[model samples]
Target chain A: MANMYNDKVMDHFMNPHNVGELEHADGIGTYGSPVCGDMMQISIQVKDDKITDAKFKTFGCGSAIASSSIATDMIIGMTIDEALELTNKQIIDELGGLPAVKVHCSVLADHAIKSAIYDYAQKTGKHYKGLEGFDPNAEEEDHHDIPEEEE
Target chain B: MRQVYLDYSATTPVKKEVLDAMLPYFSELYGNPSSLYSIAAESKDAIAAARKQVADLIGAGEKEITFTSCGTEADNWAVMGAADALKNKGNHIITTKIEHHALLHTCEFLEKHGYDVTYLDVDKEGRVAPAALEAAITDKTILISIMFINNEVGTIEPVKELAQIAKKHNILFHTDAVQALGNIAIDVKELGIDMMSMSAHKIYGPKGIGALYIRKGVRISNYLHGGAQENKKRAGTENLAGIVGFGKAAELAGNNLQAHIKHTSALRDRLIEKVQAEIDHVYINGSMKHRHPGNANLTFEFIEGEAMLLYLDMNGIAVSTGSACSSASLTPSHVLSAMDIPVERIHGTLRFTVGDMTTEEDIDYVVSTLKNVVNKLREISSVSSKKGW
Candidate 1:
């Protein structure tokens, strides 16, 4: 893994932030499939429509682990609008990029965040246009192409 | 940092003695064996000697061995070639779902070429049931291909029983013994195996060389078609150095087989015992009691394999996993999928194969480091054993 991943990926993988659940959090989202053996959960505390806190649990590869770590950290103190705007590419770019095969992990991380926000909106009985028609478990083709990723 | 490589099933460093035996073949005695010069006789005789050594290891006749480029080629020739030769008798093939991609993909390719294949399923222990073997056999079944030991789970198949069944049905049986060669006892005659595949690199010989043992009177169509090499069966100039190294490795492995197995299995068991004792929600894959002496596969729950593999690599401990994160696909290993081990376990699985050179200190260091790695990953895990799969 040392040679396979960059320093940032290893750093986040080794020492992830906000690693546990937020008890009675305003919103929770879980993504990934048992068939692929990658699962992630995101729990957020919302205050004034702002994410006061966010934590995560990931059951995936280094890319997924780091993706979850950074995704949760990046969303703290962010308003629902700001959190929804965060892209998988931003997480991957911040982590110095993942192997081509592992880029899906970043997507999974993005899915977890949206799912969490969706959960928050549903509990508050308010629907966010950002999550309109978004399926947490379905694979999305909305990948932000990084020049670094080749087919 | 100390290096502890536990991926012997992937390949091994060539031994010093094998290197020494092959050096002369590379330069000093570098004559083409097909040439009719007295100098070239050295190459011919050397090849014969190597064949004898390899034959001695498998307890087969030296004349029955056909040196191949590697285990894949050996496997390719065994399945595709046998299918071609026996096309008149049958167009159906029988194999297990847990085979290496060499067999699985070759069988698949054959299927695309109008061959019918029956993929036998394994039990949780990764053993192909004899009943399944018998049931899959038909009048058009030309060959039954199964691996002696699965590469990923290290589970040993009932090759002897399967071979006997194939014999009873008058079908040829081929076992890919790539992972089983030096670690397990094999007697082709006694096992009633019609053919078997073996690689040099797995037994501390040079890479790019292997041999397929075709039992006497069993016929297979030629794979490579150029020269009249390999008794007009396989063509191309021999991999002279690799063949010599393979012979040396085979002789060394044959002579030291028991000692090698005992040493590796001892370290393997200790590693297993230590990890299980120190960790929770860890499960061993396949049948522990009926596995290769030096192999262990386990899953530390709630963690994906790539993360664990990377962490272990950082700790100077090399292991492999079922994660396809290394490849372009996110699919997990087929072997674990076939075993029906929970998907989480399959994604979290790690494979450790102790080699002849692996020592107690290496295994101990790995055990200690692994205890921490598993715990640390579990600590950061969003899901635990509590997370239902």
Candidate 2:
């Protein structure tokens, strides 16, 4: 089988370029499953409206580790708006395309980045636009069946 | 490029001799075993010969063997069939907590249908004691089903002693011996089991075929009732090619079990030794002494099994966390959890099983690769945690 990961991806997994977090990060995101054997924690530092530093810690597969490592590298110098636009497909492409079965790991990276921005926006309570990337209709569908709690 | 494969407990490569024995059945002996014509008589004789081979391997009579698609179906038939047939006598069935999902899930299914089931627990080493089993039995217990050997931790159960207890109580005994057959020498008569399941692919035989040994005078209902096949027990045109392959595999195992044990045990022990000596914070999951000669289940803390598997894949080595059936669920292995291993260690468990084809060079490559990957991941995890993000 061909190596699905590029040298950059393997390098990041073997020697991740940017790992760990700033002591006082502007935002952080943590997600994954207890059922599945994977978890991810991402943190970012924003200075002057641009992501000056970004890092991640992933408890997942080789593809998952490589995907998060490359994803953190891609967002380090970009504005929050630019970083928010990054997609799972682009992350997979950066890794030379992961196995189809493992593509979900890339999706996890995309979600982690967006989740951090969501955390930042919620904390600041500012009219942040990062929530646009997340599916809005999903919230409506999920909340429509809310039953009042029993007293 | 050479790749290392450690998932031998899932399935094995069909030996060349077994393949050759099966090829003629697919082409020249294409006639159905059920057909009464002279051409079909050859097929019938072939099946009979294969039946005798299967019986000889396990110390059962030729009449006791009935072929099924795989061990899962056989397990279902044994549990559900016995429950339905003996409903007037009893509504309770007994099995162990560490049974394969083939048996575990079937027992749970029986529960929904008003049949009560008792799932006895195994000790820390994954061994279900005969004393524990005897304690769980009651007047309403109609059947006792336990696996001969665990597929994950390689813990060999006290099947013979448990079977004797069930026999004394007049309860039917069934065992899913898919992992035990060919690896361990078995004598069904001596064990006093009423029913036992075997899968061909577990040994060096073709997939999609297995057998169940039903002792004479034990009545059970049929799962498939379409045709008068398997003596009206299991229906469908026989899987002749696969069964022939299964028989050949069993015969070969019967002839070469001693040599196979020595070869696999040597490789397994060497791998275990290397992993223990090289990897830090690592622990073996099951019994060190009382386990299948071909198995080594280890937990490397801090990192997950999926991560280890991917890194190993990059180095062309293949292993598993547990049984292939539950690999996708990501739920820390229920067996490991039952053993009271910490939650963190549960995700890190790796099951490396050896086979007749494994070589020392292959074992060396796997050990070296695993040591490198585990050290890297642990370092990475510790460094990230200390950053206080």
RMSD of each: 3.0, 5.8
DockQ of each: 0.48, 0.18
lDDT of 2 by residue, A23-78 (tens): 88888886654234455678888876688988887766566677778899899898
Q: Best TM-score goes to which candidate?
A: 1
For model 1, how does the per-residue alpha-carbon lDDT over B112-147 read when each residue is reduced to its tens digit?
999999999999999999998999988999999999
lDDT of each: 0.87, 0.81
Error of 2 at B282 (Å): 1.1
Badly placed stretches (over 4 Å) of model 1 are: A125-129, A133-151
Give the CA lDDT, 0 to 100, for residue B231 in model 2: 80
Model 1, A65-105: lDDT tens digits are 88889888888988898888889899888888887766754
